[model samples]
Target chain A: MINATLRELSVALAAKRISAVELATLFLDRIQRLNPALNAFITVDRDKTLEMARAADVRLAAGDAGPLTGIPLAYKDIFCTEGWLTTCGSKMLSNFVSPYDAHVVERFKSAGMVTLGKCNMDEFAMGSSNETSFYGPVKNPWNTDRVPGGSSGGSAAAIAARLAPAATGTDTGGSIRQPAALSGLTGLKPTYGVVSRYGMIAFASSLDQAGPMAKSVEDCALLLNAMAGFDSRDSTSLERPAQDYAHDLEQPLRGLRIGLPKEFFGDGMEPGVRAAVEAALAEYRKLGASTVEISLPSSGLSVPAYYVIAPAEASSNLSRFDGVRYGYRAPEYVDLADMYRKSRAQGFGEEVKRRILIGTYVLSHGYYDAYYLQAQKIRRLIANDFVEAFKHCDIIAGPTAPGTAFEFGAKSNDPVQMYLSDIYTIPANLAGLPGMSLPCGFDAGKLPIGLQLIGNYFDEARMLNVAHRYQQVTDWHAQMPKGSA
Target chain B: MSLNLDQVERIARLAHIEISPAEAAQTRDRLNAIFDLIEQLQAVNTAGIAPMAHAVDVSQRLRADVVTETIDRREVFQAIAPEAEAGLYLVPRVIE
Candidate 1:
């Protein structure tokens, strides 16, 4: 039951082999027992979960249930789930009970899916390591000593630990892919605007995109079909025709061109990770796909540009928490100005404050042109690099992160080192391209390593097709952490 | 490009975030380190390149001005506020 894919779970659910209440209870019980060691879930309401499960059971009995109906999944704390505490892993929103649901949450609810709980994340989705979360770092399920990647670390850990069959995650500068990579799961970040951002806590408006994290690429595709849609609420939501992301999952990869960006394979990658990524590519060759040596010359600039652009946008978006309305407010302050200062300082975590400060500095009067604008221009070059590379290849492939999960304090103190961890994954976010990470292999230490796939705009089906084909022959994604059951 | 302690305090003030003298000192060092990382962009020439503010080039979709959300749950909205009175969100006094 713990290792079942979404499709298998759906089939079992439709066949009435397991009642939705029983299915939900299975995962809810797992979460109760395992979450203490992992800290993957911030909130789990069993009564509420069972209530939803009972409702799903009703739908299943009615014989009008959808593929996702009665299936339980977790949501990252970033999404505004009404009646649930949407913390975004920060003390500022620690007390925030969302009045309404995020668009993604509404979609899942409409699908009749049961919400298992809310997963933890980095504060305001700012950090590369989950250590910055107000809730303590989510320990990697593979080896509890190492850290789960962030800010979607909690979501990845929950799925990998079998606390939930699947979960939703948002990627702003590799939040979804990097954590999915580190935790040995399959997670996808769709093309920008594919999923509406309304009511999802804004981190970096342009870069922040919500996607799915699960045990398989097919599960990710099914989740994406429910997640992607046009919403009048979010002005940036794309109005493109709906796509069946799983429609091409069975497509042949015989004539596919996989782009291997030299910049991604160059330096900073651990030899173990390199070996695993290369072995994955060799498997692709056996499946009849060819690799093309491609160059994304401006990708090296992605990290610096991302640091500037993401923070600059985050500063403007986070300015809403000024002790006026919802969220945390300081108990004592001399006046309005002091209230704003004290509330924000007392509310936000260190990394959130640091990013806000960096954002304010870059967008400040004197530094605007030299920092923010330059970063934006460089962002264009990075995006243009993808446009050029995609001309020669159908999809770009590489190592998700430089290495496997690291120890808790490995790169937390050094922000630059932490920022560099997302070097390969950041380019996708910058370009608004769809990218996914699937389990490739394990390191010598038995830690999981991920292979990243970046598809051109709205080409998610092809990417899933490629990943689904690879998953057909490899058991990497099926390998769970020891003692996960 | 490194930020001094005073400059860090000034930035904090502009950002409306409180920083103690001790926190400011530490923040200055970290911010300087981050600035050192960001300084790499300064060496790149972006001549004749337009700033990419968003990944997509679509213009913001205009909507009808008519009210769409009819739910006037002022009670629900203000329920989470730190302070509220007579359907108004109350904050610290702005007037002297």
Candidate 2:
């Protein structure tokens, strides 16, 4: 039951082999047992979750249920679920219960999926490791001492630990892919405008995209079917026709052309990780998929440019929390100005405040032309590099991170080193492309290695197809950490 | 490329936050390390390149000039800090 995929779980629900309430209770019991050691969840309400499961059962009996009906999934704390604590993993929202549901939450509810609970994350999605979470850091289930790659660490950990069958995650500069890589799960970040960001607490508006973390590519496809859609509330939401992401999952990749970016294989990658990724590429070659070396010269500049662009947008988006209408406010202040100052100072975590300051600095007068404008031009070059490279191949393959999850606090004090962790994954986000990380191999310590596959804009189905084909010939995705069950 | 304490203070003020002296010094060192990494972009010859802001080249979509009903200001201000007995967010009296 713990290792059951979403498809198997759906079949079980339809056959009355197990009810949604029973499934939710199994997960709730597991979470109650393991969550203390993992710190993967921020909020879990047994009563509320069972209530939703009962509703899902009713929908199933009514014969109006969808594919994901009665399946349990966790939500990243960033998405505001009405009446649930949507803290965004920060003190500012620690006490805040959202008055309305985010667009993604509404879609999931409409599909009749039961909520497992809200998962932990880095505060306001700022840091690469989950250590920056105001609540606490999430431990990698594979090795409790090792860190889980984050800002989506909790979602990845929850799925990895089998506390939930699947969970939602938002990627801005590799948050989704990195954690998924470290935790040995499949995570997908769809095209930027594919998922609506109506009430998902803003991090970097242009780059932030919510995607799914699950056990397999097929499960991710099913979750994406419900998660991706057009919403009029979000200005950037794409008005594309609804797609069945699972349509091409079983397609053969006999002649697929995979482009391995030469720049991604350059120095700065751990030798063990490079070996694992190369072995994965060899498997692809054996599967009748040919590989070619392509150049994305501007890929080296993605880290620098992303830091500036993401923070600039983040600073502007976070300015809305001024102790005015919602979220956290200081208990006492001398005046309105004092109130804003005290609230922000006390509410935001250190990393969040640092990003806000950097963002405001780059976009401020006199610096905007020099810093913000220059970063914008470089962002275009990075996007164009992908455009040029995609012309040569159908998909791009690379390592998700430079190395496996490092020991916690190894680079905590070194911000530059931490920022470089997302070097390979950021360009896909910058280009508004779809990317997925699938478990390929493990390092010497049995830490997981992820092979990243990036596709052209709105080509998520193709990416999932390639990943699913690869999974058919390998058992890496099915490998679970010792003692998880 | 290292930022001085004064510049950090000024940036903090412009960002509408207050920082302590020791905090500014620490932030200066951290920002210096990050700025050093960002300096890599300076190596690219981006002269005469048009700055791209949004992903797609599109103009802002404008909505029709219709009167959208406004929410009750009094109700909204009810949650506002420093609110007085009336519908306003009260601050200390500015004028003597």
lDDT of 2 by residue, A47-132 (tens): 99999999999998988888999999999999999878889999988878877799999999999999999999999998888999
Please state the CAPRI-style docking class of candidate 1.
high
For model 1, the stretches where C-alpha displacement exceeds 4 angstroms are: none
TM-score of each: 0.99, 0.96
Task: Give the Å error, residue A108, model 2.
Answer: 0.2
Each model's lDDT comes to: 0.94, 0.90
Among incorrect, acceptable, medium and high, the docking class of model 2 is medium
lDDT of 1 by residue, B1-96 (tens): 878888999999999999999999999999899889899999999999999999899998887789888989899989999899999999877886
lDDT of 1 by residue, A11-109 (tens): 999988999999999998888888999999999999999999999999999987999999998999999999999999999999999999999999999
* Candidate RMSDs in order: 0.7, 1.9
Off by over 4 Å in 2: B62-96
